[model samples]
Target: MSKKSFTLSKIATLCAVALSTSAFAEQAKDKDIERVSVYGQHHKNYITEQADSASKLGITIKETPQSISVVSRALMDDFSLDDINAVLESTPGVTVEQIETDRTYFKARGFDITNFQVDGLGIPQDGGDVHGTLDTSIYDRIEIVRGANGIMTGAGTPAATVNMVLKKPTYTTQASASASVGSWNKNRLEVDVSGALTDNHAMRAVVTKQRSDSYLDRYATDLTLGYIAYEGQLTDSTKVSVNYIRQSKDADSPLWGALPLFYDDGTATDFDVSTSTAADWSYWNNDNEHIFVELEQSLGTSWFIRARYAHMTNEQDSELFYVYGTPSAETGLGLTGYASEYDYKDQQNLYDLYATGDFSLFGQTHNLVFGVSSADMNYQDSSLYDYTTGNGFPAMPPLEDFEGNAPIPTLEDAYNGSKVEADQKSAYASARFKITEPLAILAGGRYTEWDSEGLSYGNSKVNSSEEFIPYIGAVYDFAENYTVYASYTETFAPQSEQDQTGMALDPITGESKELGIKAQLLDGQLFATFAIFDALQDGIALPDTALSTPDNTVYYAAEGINSDGYELELSGRLTDDLSASFSYSHVDIEAGDDANEGKLVRDYTPEDQVKVALNYQVPVIEGLSFGANYRWQAKTSRVQSNGTIPTVTTQGAYGLLDLVATYQVTERISATFNVNNVTDEKYLHSLYWAQGYYGAPRHYAFSINWQL
Candidate 1:
């Protein structure tokens, strides 16, 4: 079907379901065989006992056959996680890598996470070039579902999906404020006020700002974030809500790349954690604005329909300097500089409509959900400065005492990029069938159409239409508080990847299978999940070795890669005085599929990783609490390119420790202290094009929270 027809079909189908239900409302009696909640309220704690990210059916953690993690606001506050990156570090089975100070990458199960949602509405996050752009203060919780999410989100990977649930306006009056100070002259302030504006209307707004000097020399940051929301109850069973967000971030003298890996003598150079590759004249600034609106109507007591739409715009401008090449210990003559100034803007429109309700067949109760979603993204005019003309700057500079106060050069407009338009539309349906009191089966599918064209100096060469992805799962509660389940899901993603012959390759498809056991212990306070999964990425273009040419023009054929892993996690309150969130992840990925140059390591992802955190409320004291977090990862290895720069780098394994303490000063006031990298262990944070980015050294921050 065409893109428009695809979306229209979804809406038509969902509306049909609603109409049929309404028609049969009088004839059918309420025989509730299964009672489930779609989106339930969360309690105040560092852990969420249940979530619905993995399954739209609102299945409990013990019932969903997947690896899912929920980062609650209380957990974020306990860990002082002000940003996405910090919260991700505390989450299980996830890894974050920094390409620069702004652009970042997140990986799970040896694949990239290309799917993101807010309140179940797919957000068009095109790419996560900047990872920590989202503010945690504006969110109620973050849901991370590992493996494929094709059942709910279309055109993605089997890696994972991140769903950020925004904070809503409370009908009750609430207000809070916080102030913080930390090392490197870092300071932050935040204010949040929410209450009922009228009997049927409520409003909430959040304002937060942070300014800090970095551990790296010449690097500083100023960030401001704001969110405002209003909700109105039109009728007893109808509600409408709207929210807007504005985020502005400015990083002064941010690092475009990382420290040089090699010295003039061809030996690797190691620098202190305070080392910086940013020039004093470099800065990266970004502004993001988004508006979201949602409408909900209750079809009946057992069913509901929700419609949502969002518009987002992002603007970024940067004058960055990349300092590369290792300096010689004897001459310090190998450092080089590359400068660039660019402006880019992106805007997207997102829409989704869905309905969910319960039905009865053969004396058993079941649930059905149908939805339609579409996202259209447009790239406005963009410009980049030309650099091939000349450097005109020192190719070799002192690395140790490099203080870049050089005059900023005027920028010349290069090629003005063409307006790029991309869109994805999909229709999806899912159902849960209860075969027995303790056994249930879940199935879903999505049909999607994708299109893209008019890119910078390039046009759309590959697209897809009428592609259907399938999802299936089975859950059985063999005993009380224990469940065993398995699931299989698939996704399709169109790629711009070209073969060696410069021909655009076909799209990549991912299929994942998972089997797990979940347990609820300590009277439902402790939740633990153990899962084993294997995922395959197929339809990837691989070079044909038989017809290979040295000029890089070779025929290509489809190939497949396999990745399997094990995940074990435990979350929730261990005891009244103690709580913990921890997990261990291990993945084995293999590529090549016996084609071309043979199978080798496909990614730089670590094969083994473990994360543990504990929060203890002092039983002896009224308002004293302490916690610590630790993370360990195996070595990360990547193969260098062939030709003039063939080499290999295998970073050693490392572990990090963090500590936190909080004291209650009054009924509404509290103090907190957080120390990151408590052991001061230096490790590799990320790698980009053979460059190494080091982790930060020891740092401490103190803050105060007041609520009224």
Candidate 2:
């Protein structure tokens, strides 16, 4: 069937389900089932008690047949992790590729993570690059589910899924404020206020604001965030919640692209950590707004139905400067520059409905959940550029003398542009059945109708018409504290990238298999897991260096790729006053089932990585605590050819250490000091592209906070 036909049919099905909810509720009155509350813990801890990101069924992380990781509020506070990039860097088996000052990419298991969510609602990423900043001030915790999550996200890569859980309003009033001073003239101030607005505590709100400067030359950031929610009992058996979120970012002197890593002599170039390619006039601004509504009604005494709606919009505007071309080691004369203007905006509307309950089947109690969701998005972008011929960009000085003083380029001419519309509709159902007292099985599948009508770089985008992805998993409790499990799932990703002929590449398809064991130790205060995963994908897009288009866009397509890896993680309170987290990850990626079989792939990502975090309350001091975070990675290298002569830039194995100390000055006041990159190690920020930039040097931050 055609994509339009399938979409129409799916819409009809969803409509039928929506209309039949009343009838189903009536029928549920006669059924004998157990009532279950799908709620998680309310307090902060080093480990999460329950998470639904992997299944949306509200199950314990230990019982779920997948590898799960959590960055808890306590951990974030201990490390002073106020940004998404910093949070991901401390996550296990995850890589943060900061290719430029303003753009970043996240990867897990050697694949880019394109799927993300707020709470349990999916929000597809705009592209591989993350533009602007993602602050963590509004989030309560972050849940990461490793491997394919096709059951929750219908279409995406086999990488992990990141779910940011928002901070809910409190029934009681709470307020906090902090001021920070850091290295390189960096200073920041933040304020958070949350409380109930009504006598019954039905209406609540949370508001936060932050402003900060950066370590890089001419860089600064400002942020404002707000959230309001209303939750009240409409009737004895029904409830409703309405929420709104707003966030904005204004940044100055953010680089659009990275600096050249090599010289014309096939040798690596050296630059200070403070070096930047940003022009004094460059700036990036972003805004995001969201509104969500949910209604839940109880059916009889056991079943409950939920319906949700969300609308979100994001906007970005920027004027950026990029420096390219390898300079001469002797004369520093080969470098050139370009200035560009970008304006883009997108909006999405999503709807979801589901029901959950426990029913008796085959003389045993079982859990069932089913849902339908629809998402629609529309977006458009425009780009303009300015460059020079015999010299650097119009106002750019020589490479050696560059200091971000160039004049802003005129952006009157439209060089490239795109407008696109995308829609996805999915129906999914999953159930957990008790085969025995110690064994349970999960089975489910999702049917998706995906459609895209758009033009990018003057070429039509292509996507799959329809797909049905299956999911299955099993868990067996061999002991009171240990359980072994396995899971299998598949995923599909549509490609917007073009081939040599400017035609969109075929969609990528992949499947993942994972086997793991989970254990609870130290009287269940600590959680440990070990897992092995294997995944294979076809039609992955790789840069085709042998070909290029008139627009300077590189073509790409790799037939087959395979990845296998193992990870071990342990997290929680080692003692009453000591909390810690540790992880070790190793993965190998290679070409598969093609002429390039056995060739290594994604060498830019390290094959081995280790991370450790610890926080300890001082036994001798009444109000003092100490914490540390350390990360180490194996050597990573990338090969770039300088006119047929291959040159390799290698960042040797390295480790970074960060220390934190916090002291409670009074009942309502505290002070914190943080030191990062204690050894001041110098290294490349990332090798995702041929060009690269330097990472930050040693930095320190001190903050004073007061709470009520």
The C-alpha TM-scores of every prediction are 0.92, 0.92
Candidate 1 stretches with Cα past 4 Å from truth are 1-14, 17-44, 123-128, 264-266, 325-330, 381-383, 386-394, 416-418, 457-462, 497-503, 541-558, 593-603, 641-646
lDDT value, residue 425 of candidate 2: 88
lDDT of each: 0.77, 0.79
Cα error of candidate 1 at position 428, Å: 0.3
Candidate 1 collision pairs: none
- The digit string of per-residue lDDT tens for model 2 on 457-510 reads 676665545678999999999999899999999988777777877676766789
Candidate with top lDDT is 2
Write the residue-wise lDDT of candidate 1 on 1-708 in tens digits.
455555566567766766575533332245332334322232236666456776566456666778888888887887778888888877777888776778777778877777777777664345545533667899998989999988777888788888888999999999999999999999999999999999999999999999999888888999999999999999999999999999999989987877766655455567777777777988889899989999988765667778899998888888888776656758767777777776788888998887776677776677677877888887765555545456424474666677766446555746555577888877788888889998989998988877876656443334444579989999898999788999998877776545665666666777999999888777777778899999988876565667765754444556677789899998777777888888999998887645422133344677889998888888889899999888888887655543465556567888888899999999999999999999899877775346766788999999999999
TM-score of 2: 0.92
What local lDDT score does residue 161 receive in model 1, on the 0 to 100 scale?
88
Candidate 1, residue 214: the lDDT equals 84
